[model samples]
Target: MNILILGSEEDIHAAHLKKSLTEKGITVDYLDTRLFPTKLKITWQAITHTGCLIFPDGRKWDLADINKIFWRTFGGVNVPKLTDSYQERIAVNDSMGLLRSFMRSQPEKWVNSWEAYEFHKEKPLQLSLANKIGVTIPATIITNNADEILEFSQAFKDVIFKPVYGGSHTQFLTKEHLEINRMKLALSISPVTIQEFIPGTNIRSYVIGEKVYSAEIRSSSLDFREDKRAKLIYLETPEDMKKQCLAITKAFGLKWTGIDWRFKPNGDFFFLEANFSPMFLHFERETGCPITEELIQLLTS
Candidate 1:
């Protein structure tokens, strides 16, 4: 079977997956979004719904032959030092537009389709569904209003904040951050997601189809990722928790997802966020979960 990995060529996760798939005697190719317009070409016939992907070295692959597309990354050269800014935007957008058109026209074989990407972007909706499912979730608010931010911070004494759309590291809302002027200036640029900070073990559950593999991430830092020495240890998910994880994944319409949680001291887990394209090489290596194997199976099947 020929599988397409939709990700950057430099993405370690994609590279690892390519290696694994190739070892299994599967033909694997990377569809790095960044390589378009400059190093590659795309063409499609409207009437026939036929198309082929042209690579840099004159190699072309008929789009129909692709068995499955492993949805990993979406977007064109995220960091291109093009000579012209305006032109760069046009180039990237144009390339992405056509690529998306092709993606939209293709048959349904995406591991987690473009729709999953849309669902992931709406954190508010995801959290709401989690809460409705009876899953524990921290009280949270998303807004750019400085007054509301300060009010929420004051109400929940200990609170943490991050980007509403997910990018920056989570930071505690400190006493000094209560200043309206500072918050107004910073938040005016973009909306911020502030949540009541829950102290507990950092847990991540990888839901692949009907299986849920979990791990306890140990770190001294507020954001486990900030700690270079952070460790991921395998953990058995409680039957109840497993059901919740599966529900969350299905609710999100995700074929594979990484659900972050906070296991509070009271033996309860507070739902954090669900990652549609979470990196898993580290989790697999440390926890010995068959993450790659399952993903490969999903794509090849």
Candidate 2:
């Protein structure tokens, strides 16, 4: 069987996956998206329902021949530089439109389909879907207006905020954050997700098909990822939790996912968010979870 990898060698996770596939004697194709529609070419024909990936170095791949794909990252396509502004706009539209079509076309081949990956970017929608499925989510408000955010701040004793589309680390929504000029400029540009901060242990559950593996993340920092010394402890997956995770994964039309939870000392946990492209080598090494094995099985099955 042949598998295609979208990310480049610089991404350690993608590198490891490619190496493992090679060791197992699987033919793997590399398609570094950073070079697309510029340094490389993609051709698809509706009549034949086939295409080819043409590399500058003369390597080629038939789309029909690839059995599966590991879309680690959609590392954006770089448009070729052009002196004419209008030409640049046309180039951008053409490249993006074609790439979007290519990505969404072969739904069965992608590990987690493009639809799932795109929906994961809409945090508010994610929460709503999970909530409808009986998952308890943190009390939250999404807004771009500074006044609305300031008003929401009054309701909670402890509040935290993070970018809706995700880039920066989570932080406390203090008075300094509401200072007029800074927030007005930023909020006017993009919205943020303000949530009632839940003081609980962080738990990460990985769901591959119907199987679940969970880890307890112990850290002193508000955001455990910022803490260099955070610890990961393996946890047995309760039967009910396993079913819930699988439901969430299916609800998002995903083959696999990483679901984060806030586990309270009182034995209750709140769903935080589900990640479409969660890094897992560290989780595997620390928890002794056979995530990669399951991933390979899923891809090659």
The regions of model 2 sitting more than 4 angstroms off are: 179-185
Q: What is the C-alpha lDDT of each candidate?
A: 0.87, 0.88
lDDT of 1 by residue, 146-165 (tens): 88887788787699998888
Q: TM-scores of the models, in the given order?
A: 0.91, 0.94
The candidate 1 region of ten consecutive residues with least summed lDDT is: 73-82
Alpha-carbon RMSD of each model:
2.4, 1.6
Best by lDDT: 2
Error of 1 at 72 (Å): 2.3
The best candidate in terms of TM-score: 2
User: Compared with the true structure, what per-residue lDDT tens digits does model 2 show for residues 239-275?
Assistant: 7677789989999888989999998888778898999
